[model samples]
Target: MENTIFSLIPPFLAIIMVVLTRRVLLSLGVGIVSASLLLANFSLTGTVSIIYDAVKGIFVSEGSLNTSNIYILLFLIILGIITSFITISGGSRAFGEWAITRVKSRVGAQIVTIFLGIIIFIDDYFNALAVGQISRPITDRQKVSRAKLAYLIDSTSAPICVVSPVSSWGASIIALIGTILATHNITEYSAFSAFIQIVPMNLYVWATLAMVFIVALRNIEIGPMKIHERRAVKEGLVSDPNKPAVDKLQEDLPTSKKGSVGDLVWPIIALIVGVVGTMFWTGIVGSEGNVSLLAVFENTDVNTSLIIGGLLGLAVTIGFFIRQVLVYKSVDKSVFKKGVWAGTKSMLPAVYILLFAWTIADLIGRLETGKYLAGVVEIINLNHSFLPLILFVIACVMAFSTGTSWGSFGILLPIAGDIAAATDISLLLPALAAVLAGAVFGDHCSPISDTTILSATGAGCNLIDHVMTQLPYAVISALIACFGFLVIGFTGSTTLALLTIVVLLILFVIITSRRTKEV
Candidate 1:
């Protein structure tokens, strides 16, 4: 009992700090440090040697910097630089101006922005920053609250990316599925094949997107978000005093020739075309007698797909800069440098968040407790005839604590899959869905989650504010998902369960909105 309690103390203390103080970095640091100290307690050595071994073990045997993780960070950095360049070149401003002209009302602007976010579908990081920057001015002009704008951008980012087949997210999911198949000794399942099979079962991603549309179109209100929306409507446009005065300088300049919409549209198109064409050329697409895309993805030492995508985005952004310069006939080298510098600066926070999350995740992996945790989960027979709602809750908690959906899936799936093998339950779909949904739930809500932080930063809301405001909505949806999973677990009809949840959520939102108005 003492050992068990001691083993659990670090994660518990971390949560307490996060909730009480809302300092994500501090919480993560404390958890990692405490875990390291606990690990040192087991080793018989001098203080320095014990500390050295703990830190070394973290990045070596446990969570060493692998090619895959390196690639993810590389993609993030390159994408950040490209996004920064686009913003500096006046592309975002041009897009904002064009969007404002088309959107006559606040609701229309919000809906259109969400639609645009759906269409991007290249990468979540790209989608978040580009959409937020392009739509911020337009939404502000329409008297829409920054909180609402942030919510829309955040909602659309991960959900859309997870579902789309041609994205960085898609690539990651494919890799994970491949690992699953290999571990199961299944030779017939390919990444693309598995992806197609799992797509329909990804209820959480689809459900979240559906909710965003319902809220935007029907003007639904719930929790803190509803309060923020009401305040925005009643107070009109409350100018952010914290915004730098340099922002005002852009107001007086004549709109660029490409326009804000043009700025946003062209670069996105280039990125899509480049990624698709490159993937096809490299045999990622099914072609006759050619190497399989999966083979290429696996064999390549670098994350070639993301590298290719980033390079393409960069080229298109450069073209936009040239076009602006030539059209205005007042371009200089300094202008280009300024754009690049601005883009890089905007991405700094995202870079910091990613690095910290990566380090913390690595630290967690080092603890022998992680393996013990996995063993405990397996021993519980959680996959066998368990209550779906309880399983959902457990999955969420595990994913949240670990800060990784893929890792959580790896741990849970085999155990869950074994249960499926033994019972009447069709383990493939439900188990996979549970893993995906739980990971997304944790990813969406956890303050230390890189994706969550990016969403907040991209939306330009205070980090804590975004986390606090978004929590209620995420929880409501998760509860709905939990109940839906229960229904599916009993009936084994996921489609029916999903449809039922959608309809009920829609009705609930409508009733809630009406009640708030009456009050």
Candidate 2:
């Protein structure tokens, strides 16, 4: 099972169960047990040990605490608390009212979310959570579904970061490219330059971004997203009432009549400033000497920065809570404890889901699911012209199965480099670009993906609803990207491939808008 077809069973089982049951934790739990069983060869004690070690590993790795995972979980709680106070201070309500007057239309609300998502391209995690906080109130006021908002956040977060050279994703990829270039004895182009060149080659990013804007502007809700839009438009329910959401705890919280938009805007500003400041600080501190922008991003501790930012945001929110109760006298002092608890409680679901996801992802890694998939790709003798397309599909499967785009990058990028170097060195960048695109595509579709979970959490959407609704759009963009990769593989023309993708995307938007009911 470690490096064979059997390794694929656990993740697929979990994913299929999630689609069928619409229960994220249960599905992930089942997947975890299944993976442990497979890894233990059906032995009860071995299975238990494997499960224990995997769960334990989430917090402790190699005798030290897994600060990254722990910090991320803490940040979510802090974000939740901040959200609670923001709502209690009437910031959310006030912002919604203000946005209603200014935005005026559903399309405008969606566009604002997309724009924010694109602008905050430093890290996908920050973009997903922060943009959701800023855009959710506006989208809610405009009757936009949480699922659609999640789609916008998810699509924008990774797709934008993957292409931006100054982003954490770009930094990691450049570092990997540097190592791969060195290993293959290829030095014609520096890693940074190669990364810049491949930016245009990541067709999925452009396709997904185009699809997001087109869907927003044209009011095209494809597949299950249509149902969500219909519900939001007709019934005024942004989220599914029957499902559990990350923001559900704030539903009944008291709000102040005296609250102003500054209550919301100021804390978010602090969060952004704190996080970016910390990112720079960490990156500079971690670097050996003479640092550049890319070095800062590459060396920055994202989870630590997030927690520090979350703390700053939380403090600012608490100050607002105090002002509402003390200065304005609009909110009751008695609501303080209740509001804090509710806010903290709201993020518990996201935390539990992340914990389970991390556990299952660990087990899947132990099974070598991605390695097996890569091995299968390596054995297949195909024409060099098809290598880019083949790598794209394989990378998609690997990232989807493993539920981590970074993990896919670590596993498949070197393999892609080696294969391209052996067959046709000229195809190296194209092949690498395919892997990057495929990994993001796969990450978008995976239920266990942290970015997917964070997007849904940030939007206050049901996890399953987010996953199901975004599937068709992700698939559409991926299909377009696949065609682009096919074109790139054969013709080696990034320009022609991009042109084909843009043309197909426009046709898709036109056809879908004509057929679908407008929200």
Query: Please, what's the RMSD in Å of model 2?
Result: 1.3
Q: In model 1, what is the error at residue 29, expressed in angstroms?
A: 2.2
Relative to the unseen true structure, what is the C-alpha lDDT of residue 303 in candidate 1, on a scale of 0 to 100? 44
TM-score of 1: 0.79
Alpha carbon lDDT at 269, candidate 2 = 99
Worst 10 residues of 2 by lDDT: 510-519
> Best by TM-score, which number?
2
Candidate 1 C-alpha lDDT tens digits along 103-142: 8887898887798789877666557756765677678778
Error of 2 at 486 (Å): 0.8
Tens digit of lDDT per residue, candidate 2, span 1-519? 798899999999999999999889999999999999999999999999999999999999999999999999999989988999999999999999999999999999999999999999999999999999999999999999999999999999999999998888999999999999999988799999999999999999999999999989988877788889999999998888888886568458888988999999999999999999999999999887889998999999999999998899899999999998889999888988888798889999999999999999999999999999988778999899899999999999988888899999899999999999889998999999999999999998999999999999999999999999999989999999999999999999999999999899988967776676442
The total of clashing pairs for model 1 equals 6
Range of the 10 consecutive residues with the lowest summed lDDT in candidate 1: 244-253
